[model samples]
Target: MKEKDGISECPEQQVILYVEKEDGKYEAMQTGSYISANYLDDYFLKRGTLEKALGEKIARGEINAIEYYMILEDLTISELAARAGIMKWTVRRHLKPGNFSNISESALKKYSIVFNITVKEIVTRQSGNRN
Candidate 1:
């Protein structure tokens, strides 16, 4: 089946599945192309007890994608700074939207420590306009 955006979902028996996003929303093209509730239950059971997780982090009265990336991975500015070998302010500047640029190694390291995630997961080249 095709979704409004013409995206199709190809369901598989794998426990972990990938969902496509269109215009910032999830779209399913056809039934059975997506996993059913029962499938999720069985997948979660096979893995372990699931914990509540947020899609992103809220900060400064705004939902910044960088903030969400850091929070979801459990990273902090100070820690990331140390890892990048740069000042915290530098890290902040890079994290801000529209400031698409490379981050220092020290910052990447700190992010890894705080979020318990990998450097590859934290850093992303901005897409489209900087802001």
Candidate 2:
């Protein structure tokens, strides 16, 4: 949208939007949330519940880092595989703790890139872990 035509969502929430300059380069612009405050609050509440439940599962070792990050990022197995440059089946395998042991260092690095985390963090991070 044009700068003047930008939407006003939540006055309290700030978001980043890219606007095209006259020179054709996109620039970062600060904008409001896409949704209203009440909707954003509801979304945050639901996401918080999901995070808490997922964190508990992770703490119980029911799911590993790959699955945790993938779920939090809202990525499908196919999307994750493509982002990490792995096969769909391989991504699925690594989602479990047992099969994660078979993954290589290079693959770990790729996951780190995809998750925007460190390899050490992936292996050692606990539930509710955030930087």
Candidate 3:
């Protein structure tokens, strides 16, 4: 892959991983979450770590630079809604900022199970700036 800056440009065949951000940093994330890359700072707690890692990788040319692509592989709202057995509107509501707070633990658990990803990955804490 062609490296640029410090972000990986995922290949067409590769799935774009989603990470959560909290408190102005990047956090790990589980699948099926609605967090968007555009709001990475808001949902991710480990931005420093991610940036550092990507920077090193970019310097070595191990991966391409990061850029947003129109295509993504993560589940859509409708797909998540189907798995949750809820209406699409419910999924949309859960993805909303204020509405996300209302999602029940049980619902989150079910979503995690269906997506086969860990809650920790979904909600990662920010790592310290030790690099």
By lDDT, rank the candidates, best first: 2, 1, 3
Query: Scored by Cα lDDT, where does model 2 land?
Result: 0.79
State the TM-score for model 2.
Answer: 0.66
lDDT of 2 by residue, 1-131 (tens): 56645556676888888877667787877878777644877888989998777777777778776787889899999999999999998888888855666889999999999999998887765424421
For candidate 2, the 10 contiguous residues with the lowest summed lDDT are: 122-131
Cα lDDT tens digits, model 3, 40-120, are 566355655666675454344443221000001246667767876767876666655334336677766666565565544
lDDT of 3 at 120: 44
TM-scores of all predicted structures: 0.34, 0.66, 0.37
Give the Cα error of residue 3 in candidate 3, in Å: 33
Error of 1 at 89 (Å): 1.7
Q: Which pairs of residues collide in candidate 2?
A: none
- For all predictions, the C-alpha RMSD in Å is 15.8, 7.1, 20.0
What lDDT does the true structure give each of the candidates? 0.48, 0.79, 0.44
Q: Per-residue CA lDDT of candidate 1, range 1-103, in tens? A: 1134333244543233234555565554333323542366676764443211222122222333445555544568776666556678877887665453365
**lDDT winner among the candidates?**
2
- Among all windows of 10 consecutive residues in model 1, the one with the lowest summed lDDT is 50-59
Among the numbered candidates, top TM-score falls to 2
Off by over 4 Å in 3: 1-73, 125-131
